[model samples]
Target: MLTTRVVVRGLAGLLAAMAVLVPSAPPASADQVRGSQSRVLRTLGVDAAWRVTRGAGVVVAVLDSGVDPRHHDLAGSVVTGPDLTRGANPRGVRPGRLHGTYMASLIAGHGHGPGRADGVIGVAPAARILSVRVILEDDEPGFRHFNSEARFENVVARGIRYAVDKGADVINMSISKDRPTRQERAAIRYAISKGVVLVAAAGNDGAGKADGPYSYPASLPGVISVAAADRALHKASFSNRNSLVLVAAPGVDVFGAGPGDQYWVGRGTSQATALVSGVAALIKAKYPRMTPALVAQALTSSARRRTARGYDPGMGFGVVNAARALAEAARLAGYRHTASGAGVQDPDLPIAAGGADGRPQLAPVQVVARDTGLVTMYGAVALGAAGCSAGCLVVLIVLVRRARRRREHVMIENPQADRRRRAPT
Candidate 1:
């Protein structure tokens, strides 16, 4: 017999730390007086990216704990959407509840101060945040107990649909779950079909472990799974790693607005996910016609890979590079490519295919016939077999078999022949 357990994706370490710091700090300064701008802003090259676009017209839907619209940093940037969390009003943030508010500020916070010491500035400072409350933090009747997986799924699914219907270009789901229901999966597909760029947190449960269970929405096809990295550009100890982790961002000591116009520094994959969503908003704002697939491609293709060779379970393509992704998005805007629905895995071959650590995976390949006249023996074999005499076809078959046997003999004698063949001339 098998049993299934539902786990909420929210990480508690950073939030708990923030709670402790909030009360002891000075009234004027909520927490320690650190730099107003997060180090991640510079790490991700947000300054250069901002010069390109401040995510002017893009609306990023934040599906998490309710966002406080009155927060100074996010005052004009937040557009309050439906509150799926029971007893949580859409107008205000519950006392001490700051998850959604923090996420919003990370995506579009317009700091109150003049320099890095005074206020918080988001990667896309001009982007608008659509606050769609999906996670319930209160001790309501139906959500009193710790485990409310079924209810969580229902509300999150509704939130996704709501964001899409409301014209959200990017849906930022910082919440995570161990498993996904059929309804939730369909909702994700629906969002992708509408060309909404979905981004989610790669769970933070791999502190001392090398591998951990995958988190959903993040693991789902088409959703960009973001892992957390510290200011030093190292993968955060708590950030879960897997093939689904598409990219990483600064999640350690990340500073953002809290409730009651306060600010706090926290570290979690949730913060990393929010940062990626902001970058996606920037890309979408610049290229309004870009599809979700191409947006993902822009991010992964332009990411700073961990190793020079290829992808790794710890960092996926690597940390998110905002400037490079923005540049790539601009370049992609000029190209004509089929718009694939969300969750479409990249079709490119493995960068280090056939290497010691890299195994070649079978992927679909597309072939196109161009106007330039190019012919091969295979084409001749097909045409001759279809319209010419059987004698010609027989001859072609014999020649093909001879070529195959010769190739097989060479491979049997020298298995590393491709390595040599691929060497630079």
Candidate 2:
């Protein structure tokens, strides 16, 4: 159970300040080529990554305000999963409720103009989005009618579980709370166990308080915590600086799709988190069997180290390098073979070798071939599942079976039900 007083006291001041600081949504526009203005894409080498993979056959779950699935830039990418907020209509677009839509576009938006270069082309343009509504608009009328912190907590927890159960490859949580609860921790652990990659924002309270409490989910174990970087690859002043921050991305003046077929600019760790999530989707598309821990390793290991030393409080490892990370993932996927002995050739193999003396000598050589069979198998499976969209059905069946077993266990533990019924007559 949650008390309204605690939530009001904890978030009222912060939410009020954000309403004034964060830019308001702009009017709908016809110009769709504005995505080139996004500095993050150019700085992070997204174009090079796209040459290798476009995040096809991957699903990223966005947990935030409801996304506008019908947005021009996000058409056919957004999949409405669930609306956990109380009294809020599912998938309904309301004014001041476009945060999730913006985040979704940043992760997987496919531009709608004359060509692919137009509009907001997300870092992972071919990825699909699983929109899970977990936030409610504070400006809505009768906002106090909803339940207290418990409601918010339950919604977030449920959203995480739902995303994992629905076969989300990467889970992007752009929203943040000051602290983590038991339910939230359990939900995150559950997702990690299912091989889901979790990414979250490091909070935006960095003006005078660089030492604020670590943000929830982002600071949680097994979650990739992201900080905000500006166009120059420097940490944003408003991005909270904590040791929990794992990496940084371009979050300043980040452009994305908004509600009512409009586009807007946002600045915060939320945008940075979304960018990282998109990159994670790309990695998953290339290597579907990658574990959550290895995914984090791929991002951090290949990051462009900006600081002189090991780590920085503001920048974490450094700005994410998408091309470098993808290259690393590719290397990780190759097969490793060891030679039996140094400078030894196969006895039965015919080899033409020339030394200083005009005599046949063993030529020093080695050959390594990729396991194309395994690669083809995984590729075929990915293509088949994407063609039919049967990924969710498999997960749904597993979840249903688990639920049934749990209910059966409860009935077995409670024999009092039969005793009560027999005596009730």
Candidate 3:
């Protein structure tokens, strides 16, 4: 019950944040089946990144409305998990899965058809997806209820932990919120500690200018916040300009797969986030043990920096270049590579970044230090509770032995002790 209240209370102003990442309304138009990849591929240089790895052996968790594994491009790649919004709404409310499906296709969609040539090909075409539904579409039934429901208030926080536990190499959180929750921040820290790369949309509230409201998860430390970019390499008019923005990706007129054999062209920071997540997958697929900080380093270091010296609020370091990022990752991993981006094939690399069981591990010293006070506090509480339990057990055992001895003495030496027991009374 306390946990429930925390989750509920933690969502005090979070409802406003959800509207910034995913568009408040469904794609206004351009919803159709495109027979080829969107121009985003060319703009992102994903083909060159493919020479390094097609994101094989990496699992990206998509936390959003829900993904349709049955989509033509996403077939055989998506593994559905629990719906965070289940039963949270009142009776007779159903949600639509347009957003989540679109994001997943951008992350791991493998186009269907002869030679796998047709349909929308994702940035990381060979990666797998763990689809964990954490939100409901705005137009869907119960959308308001889901947002207002206490049980679902901590959906995004829970989804982050769930993805990390499921061995996700990278997490794509195309969703954003204005209100920051303690649970959500802790969850982001947990993922970072576990060496999981997290990417999020920088919000789409930038109306062709700067100084947009900060977006959580994206604004949260250790997360690679992605902003939307246009074909001309300019920040999208709708992309949020904030300190959290790490890198930009193609977000204008982005083509992606829908819930079925359908496709849609949408423009938002959400699409850009998915593309960045795909790039992270490629890095992890090549260097399975690279820490989240280094993975982020690889991205920021190799980006087409917007300025000469430092980062800009609009696009941060600049647009993300996949092939260059791969090269940077290879350099950080101390592995040999060819110009084609394929080189050292370390079969012995550990699958999980830290431990085999996917436990949270300590990050490198040079990595930016994050607040682990929550983890320490929880640990201290658990330790204190365990100590109390042990002390109680010791006292109980001593009392029990004393009682047994008294009973034995009453039977053997003081047979009249029982009769005299009530004397005082």
Candidate 4:
């Protein structure tokens, strides 16, 4: 879901009491995490974001194939959830749970070692993950059957409800499909209505196509659709380009924890979406009562490399900045969460007030283009000046004709005088 929102209930007691804000660790610990962190996490400044909060008290639901809870990097972080496949694996194809494990590691990997440093350190390292199996790998046994037939098409919808009921603060669906079913839409609507922040992959269909097909769940009204950005910060060739893209993340040559306690390198919007879901968990952990709309506003309003229009189909607002988004959440927290979910989500409109938590603004919306009014006003004035000038020219031409006629009449009456006047002068 993309645009749907609801009035968040119960702003009670969950501020400082809910999240045990982990103070900034000593330099040695921070340095160890930084030194061991991969280029991808470092690129997003996930280390800097840890200074504020490590996503202490939030639960992110990973709706994917299935996660390997025994992985070294994700030992205590995973809560194994239901197997929603409804059917067994195909004859020869086995379920590796490779894709799901990789995505989970990105969202909540707790690196293994003395300083928790020898492996991948996820964006929200302290966030817990609920592994809800909804989709299978492309090479898995029942992959084609599950995707092509209607027998188990509603698994995702059921997964959403299951995650919500399991007390998931954020739901991360790194899968995409071509069509939308009524049950899926209703499930998403139900999740959003319950203040669950939804995120999904925009799809991997970019290469030859300008704008790819609308990926379902990503294109839905309330889901935050993630695109894949290359190293140079451009949309990846395989990443889908569409209006549904909310923000992009480093999705090229991404390495993460895989099943069997191994590390794997993968690329796709699935990784990008997982990274963004981790950031959402970070925000949720800090501001326990922040509404879903505010969570999205924090991400989009503070996105990096944004265009002048604030949005583009290639990357939507821009790439996700973990530290910047958390700072934005601090600003949006003070806004009175209204029933209609008004005013605050708009980046263009000035917020009546901001949070007093004293976080610095990384990027602010500087330019305001009143294009419609200015164009109409200037266009009307130019048209009026042109009309007035044309009328004056016409009047002058008529006067010259009248003067020429008078001269001709005088010349006819006195041909000799006219010829003398026209001779040499």
Give the TM-score (vs. native) of candidate 3.
0.71
Candidate 2, poorest ten consecutive residues by summed lDDT: 1-10
Instruction: Report the C-alpha lDDT of model 2 over 173-247, residue by residue, as the tens digit.
Output: 886677666667768877877789999888777878757558777889989999989878888887888998999
Q: Each model's C-alpha lDDT?
A: 0.75, 0.76, 0.77, 0.77
lDDT of 4 by residue, 1-425 (tens): 11101000110100000111111222124343334346777667777789999999899999887898988789998998998874746666556676787788889888876877666678898999999887766556565566556667688888999999999999998887777776688788778767899998888767689887678788988899999888888888878888878999888766676677666555678888999999999999999888888899999998898888989898989999899999999999887453655423432222333435563323456898688988999999999999999999999999999999998999889999878877995
Assess candidate 4 and give its lDDT: 0.77
Put down candidate 3 lDDT per residue, 152-193, tens digits, no spaces.
778898999999999999999888777766668778877876
Number of backbone collisions per candidate, in order? 2, 1, 2, 8
Give candidate 4's error at residue 271 in angstroms: 0.8
Q: Which stretches of candidate 4 lie over 4 Å from their true place?
A: 1-37, 90-94, 336-425
Q: Candidate 1's residue-wise lDDT over 1-425, tens digit each?
A: 11111233232222213332343223224124335354677788987888899999999999877788877667788888876665433344353347788888889887664453345678788899899877655432333333434454477778998999999999998877767765577688788877899999888777888896698778998899998887777788888879888889888878777767777677788889999999999999999888898999999889874766668777778888889999999889986455557746433223223435464554546698665434566677788778767777889999999999999998899978867888898
Question: Alpha carbon lDDT of residue 251, candidate 4?
Answer: 85
